[model samples]
Target: MTVAQLSPQSQVAALPQTWDLERRHQSMRRLVDVVQQLSLARSLEAIMDIVRVAARELTGADGATFVLRDRDQCYYAEEYAIQPLWKGQRFPLTACVSGWAMMSRQAAVIPDVFDDPRVPADAYRPTFVKSMAMVPIRTEAPIGAIGTYWAVHHEPGQDELTLLQALANTTSVAMENVRVWSELEDRVDQRTRELDAANRELESFSYSISHDLRAPLRAIQGFCQIYLEDHGDTVPVEGRPILETVVSNTERMSALIEDLLRFSKLSRQPLERHTVSLDDLVRRIVSAQRAAAEPGREIDVAVGPLGQCEGDSSLLEQVLVNLISNAFKFTRGRTPARIEIGRRSDGDEPVWFVRDNGAGFDMRYAGRLFGVFQRLHSAEAFEGTGVGLSIVQRIVQRHGGQIRAESAPGEGATFSFTLGQGS
Candidate 1:
């Protein structure tokens, strides 16, 4: 019932002090136990049960009910009366006392239900409820209400009202926590399903490349080689050049497909991390590059002490191979191409770098450097599939690292990266 509707005599009628000091002390101890249990409750149903029992015990009431707001209805979701009273009942927001308490955002203490005009008399006719006290679960915007009832006309005092309000406040927090945790679990499940679907699609694509694409490429390359060797003299000299061009293009296509497959595989490959000597890995790549260089080409490579890092050894080796090879490819015209491999600290983490005197790119287009099949120079000037940097970036990212480059047109470039503490 609204406070304004109460008669002057009933409003100030003092409630009898039935609870002694010892009874109040026992109530306080029970309230503390209920609060502790509320924190471990995982569901709204469980929280409601705890609140229902706690409210009855703390206020020495004959019955207690937990009411939740459901749109335009007040739902008696749970009840703990000595004899059942509206255990699974629902009423219109305007017709129920619980709804009125929530709508007014205040507690209702009715000493005599039959004397109050706001009481729905017919609903209590079959039950023994003669009085009730209801406080909204939340103060500012009530989501629900906690109610206590008596079988006889009994006035509830200020202490009993205060105890019920504290229990309602704790119930609100527990319910909100359960809702937020449920939402987070649902989001995690959705993301996991999405990742599973994407992986299946990728596996299908990879299978198609390995079988369908490779079959046609292998046939073309084999036929071209047979034709050039078996019947070279039968064709006109001018026409022979066209046949050679076709063979070269087919080889380049095969190389491009292989690089694409490697790039795709990186996403699914699990990292096998361990301590790797960066200095040793760089030296091995440089040795391989020098052995494959043209006879007259001269290149000066300086390998310094690169501190060890924890990462997948094979993947780290591939990163060094790609960066060093790019340096060699871009510095084709330099009489004595200079390349340096070293590492230095950046206060928090060690930053390893590959510096080269080569054909550096414009800083404006550096954003596109790590994209697959993106190239700054034409094929005629420098031949490449342009998938190397993309692969390097993915490997570094998988290791929880960051990579960036500094460069300008005509000036040389430096690529640096940091791999965080190992997982």
Candidate 2:
């Protein structure tokens, strides 16, 4: 009110300065909004367009252009203006202000385009641009520049220069984000393609093993049986033992192929999840193993309360079979084999375990435990194809779970697994 009481000339003189400050504040607010929107730009072209338009509007420029550094050339890739400007044009770095800003790594503010020796006179003679400012997109290792033009001879204020630099900085970050996102997408696509090709090859191999390979094996087994039945008396005693050995080896090979097929199928099979009573499943597996065990061998197996878990029933059954069978197999020399199956709550997930007083392995070889055909014991000590644990690991992974073994040599082995969720 006291200022208003003064002369009208005083108030009028102050109005232009006040309006200039308000305009700059408004531009700063708009720049903030532009930067936020630019962050979400997914492509380079979109980012360029956003930067060009924001630069023109925020600085009250007659036109705006985004010039990208392409090798030794400055490419005018995009433009936003009331009149036609250099859009889709390329020039040498020596002849363009945008290029000059990028080369110097600083902002270029020219009040008179013709008076500046850096300005290319012939190139600007036909344009409405009498003054312009160019700012490097990035201060360190500048990638490009943002250029703004005016129709009349004008000097860019500090506020205008600052706002343009801010826009240029934001544009650099947006461009970088777009590049990183594109690279990530490409990598993901490449990996997906590789996985698809690998799966196809595995299917072909599985087919060969099931049909082509099995045919020859069956033929050998059949011919051996024919010789035993038809020419048993004609064959010599030593020759008969050799033929029996051949038959036994063929049977073992058949078992190996079957297990191989199962292991391969796990990679392709989709999971079917349901709540399964592990208590009942473990009991059935233990009963079967006991039946197949050596006659008169008493194995004390304690079945504890095994809580329910959500997983593929058939796959989980296979996991229990492999683990429990290993327990029984390794406990061969013990007078009374001790095996315990139980469950406990660990946080939100249920941890189920199978413990057995068996011939445990050294912890040093644990890294190779889940590999295909990696066995801790020799064939003479424990007979297996060494594919069981690998299959178990794959199944557990498919069910969004984990399986790990704890054991030391000459002590005992305990396998603990958690079924987090069904995949």
lDDT scores of the candidates, listed in order: 0.88, 0.89
Minimum summed lDDT over a 10-residue window in model 1 is located at 10-19
What C-alpha lDDT, on a 0 to 100 scale, does residue 403 get in candidate 1? 90
Q: Per-residue lDDT tens digits of candidate 1, residues 1-423?
A: 643466866545522232355677887888899989999998998998899999999988999999999988999999999889987889998998998999999999999888887789888888889999999999888999999999998999888998899999999999999999889889999999998889768866975675578778878888988998999989898989998988888888788888888888888789998899887888889999999987889899988889788999999888889999988888788888988888888987898989888889999999899998999889889888888999999999999998999998777789998887672
lDDT of 2 at 209: 67
**CA shift at 325, candidate 1, in angstroms?**
1.3
- Give a tens-digit lDDT track for model 2, residues 274-302: 88988889989999999999998879999
- If scored against the real structure, what TM-score would every candidate get? 0.69, 0.72
After superposition, the stretches of candidate 1 with alpha carbons farther than 4 Å from their true spots are: 1-67, 70-100, 103-105, 110-133, 138-142, 146-192, 199-203
- Name the candidate that leads on lDDT: 2
Q: Score candidate 1 by lDDT.
A: 0.88
